[model samples]
Target chain A: MNPPLLDVRGLTLRYETDAGLVTATSRVSFQVNRSDRYVLLGPSGCGKSTLLKAVGGYLAPAEGQILLKGAPIRKPGPDRMMVFQEFDQLLPWCTVTQNVTFALTASGRLKAAEAEERARHYIAKVGLARFADRFPHTLSGGMKQRVAIARGMAMEPDILLMDEPYAALDALTRRSMQDELLQLWEEIRFTVLFVTHSIPEAIKLGTRILLLTPHPGRVKAEHRSDGTDPAGPDGELLSERIHRELFSDAREEEAGHV
Target chain B: MSDSGTVRLPLPAARTGAAPAQRRRVWRNSPLLRKACILLVLACVWQIYAVQLDKPLLFPTLTDTLQALWSSLASGALFTRIGFTLRTLLMGYAAGILLAGVVTALAVGSRLGNDLLETFTAMFNPLPAIALLPLSLLWFGLGNGSLIFVLVHSVLWPTALSTHAGFRAVSPTLRMVGRNYGLTGLRLVLRILVPAAFPSILTGLKNGWAFAWRTLIAAELVFGVSSGAGGLGWFIYENKNQLEIPSVFAGLLTVILIGLFVENLIFRTIERRTVRRWGMQA
Candidate 1:
């Protein structure tokens, strides 16, 4: 409607490895509106993470451009924050509060006192206020992810890029985190580009799902789940249906490639 | 998907106290303490033999050494020599550490710089700092400058090597996380790289200080001209020339005491504050 918040057009990525020039993704395009929860769903080596990296301006595309609020994404900026998959995403040397404050300070967004207050606010929001003085090494995997999420949200980025942020968590923790994330999204309404291979995660979280094909990854399909069901009892059924569809689509894509 | 969703089994709580208790029992029964006791017994035996031999010039008894140490402390000669040695050691150690950091930063920041550091360290690391005494004397003249020059040489390479290795070993994911936050150049290194590589860097600093201490003593012994008057090494050399064996032993004891102070106090405190607290090292 108003020139979507992010516009990625015909994006292609190739990596020069010791083996050969490998095409990671090809002609992949997507658009995300403001406050959209968009998920990129694909199998391993489908270049979903690469696509997320491209959006964050960490990786350059072989072809095509990513525009954020009409400005071409050239390099990484504070405007696009990332929650990495690794538990060590939070710097070990820094306490939770310091980790969040680092972003605010580094970006020159606020003075020390104000930055610290803002950091506390985000840490409290992520339910880690009690652990503010604790370093990352002392945190559990889920707790570390929460710190990462809090740090990202504290930056007040236009878009939050999560690269399979919950992939490292235990099953129960992953479900709890997903629920918490949805609750946080409802409150904040921040735009999110989440990458996950898990179909349940995509269906549960994404307003729109971009299904990608493996190796030289391309957009296989796009599913708008907002109208179907909004993660209730019926939502579980819809998730199952979507899961089957993704597998069949994946199999078909594999057959076509072979 | 089923396998992916399978419940993750929780690992048992790590047995933190058991190992220590077992280690304590073994240590109580082991030859380590017994050997130490035996060594103490041998030292007493040697002291008794020296006293029986009545050889003050050739071999000072333990009591004689203690008396010499006490007299030196009372006269303030021991304190003066210790102060001089500490000043030179600290100056050389600090300079060497700073130079190592600069070199490591340059090495990590660029490919050409990395090549230069590797080549230079390879060329110089093998040459013992003592061997450079003659060249250092020629360059800086016979003074504290020459001693400092050798100390710098001794401290720099080991620190640089360990630091470089630490920098190289930093996890890629951590590096990416730093980059994602738009950190680069000096800020990136100071904030992320240094802290992440702290355990190795601390190890390097400890080794560098030890080397600097040894080099300072050796250099001072060779060039005992009392450049800033005299250090502990020069004191020992002077006492030895005068056949003052007890005073030489006192000077040696002072060196040992200082080494113990630095290792157990300064470096131990640093390790406790950083690596141990961060859970990077035990």
Candidate 2:
């Protein structure tokens, strides 16, 4: 097998506050192979989002390093695009096509016409072809999130970092989004480092789940659900088992931490 | 989870219902009728009071005022005065808006710029632009330069304050999204920051326009010019001195008319096209 696409080691982060230094993450380590849907799961304030940010080069880890494709990660670039939790992630001023074109042009990967064509293609892929000329403000919450996803995917990043991209969506919409995401994953097969607190979401979406303990987060367990096809018949049983195991581990860890 | 334990769902509607024409008519008519009634009541009260006083110097009746207005329009003097005032106002408004943009950019871009803008706005925002007219006259002489100076003073602070507030109100998520698209510098400002802060900027523009209008008229009245190229304010002042009460009332009415045209036609149209359409403001 080929070596992992992303490798992180001994990662630690501390934020400076008026009160004092607050530790957010400690000695977190992980590796994500190409085409791996790696979900980081933990309760709120567990530094899962921080870890994703660090990996995406939005934040610097106080200790250790992250290597992407044998190169050390430094600052944020088009190679790692992020989809934030808020539906407002798509800039309200931009039409759907412009939002995607913005990413393509800014990356300097294509000329204006070519970038527009690619933007149209991705906007279509995300089922937003009709909304290409519409501003984000006019879109429903689910549609806005899809636009954000299209914008991220339009960059064709080495790793897509999602910080609870569907946590804000209503349950029905969230489920539809998950199915769409899985369909997109099947087509594109890009490495993804997704952060979410939901057990079912992790089992349904992630090929590998990295469970972290809350408050100064550290990896508690890693579960591989590679064979579980969430949309298949037997997938429900496997998802339930994964959910049970993850929640139990989370509970035990929380009890131990307290 | 099986369909066997569940009740069958109802069929979806085949067609969506359209809004009733009467409902649309009512929605359109109520606001217009209400405003017209209010204006009629105010005019009746004013006409009654003017007749009771029976002093043309003190107050002119609405019909007399309307007659004066008609005469001014027929002679083209009112149009010329309005054109002059509007020209000065547009120039000052444009300059003030440009300055506010620069100041806001500096404030958002650097610490020192932020401090400078904050201090400058705090110092000047509360000072009336009319009060600055004496100093402006001394510095620039009693010409259009002085009037423009006072107008700029009137417009700049409120525009800057609102713009800065808008910039500060932009959410972190939106900023992150812009960055994710590799947007920075001028592109970032134009695409993300400007639109996100637009509602506030629109408010600032409206306030600044009102201030500049009021300041221009007051300043022009205080320093009435002898040249034929004087504004509505000068027209009002000259008519008042000559005891032409009806013309003075006409000049005042012209000012109100211009203000109404700008507010309802220009600014309202822009608000509807942008912020209201975007649902950022009503």
Give per-model TM-scores.
0.87, 0.86
lDDT comparing candidate 2 with the true structure:
0.86
Cα lDDT tens digits, model 1, A59-149, are 8889998999989898887899999898877778788999999888877777889999999999999899999999889889999999999
lDDT of 1 at B64: 84
Worst 10 residues of 1 chain A by lDDT: A227-236
Highest-scoring model, TM-score: 1
Model 1: lDDT of residue B213: 85
- After superposing candidate 1, which stretches have Cα over 4 Å from the reference? A226-258, B1-54, B226-228
Q: Any runs in candidate 2 off by more than 4 Å, and if so which?
A: A227-258, B1-30, B37-57, B226-228
Give all candidate RMSDs, comma-separated. Answer: 9.2, 8.6
Residue B62 error for model 2, in Å?
Answer: 3.7
Q: Which digits, one per residue and each the tens of the lDDT, describe model 2 over residues A1-258?
A: 787799999999888889998788999999999999999988888899888888777788899889999898887778899999987777665688988887788667678899999899999999999989997788899998898888888888999999999999999999999999999999999889999998888888999999887678888778887645343365556556555555677778779999
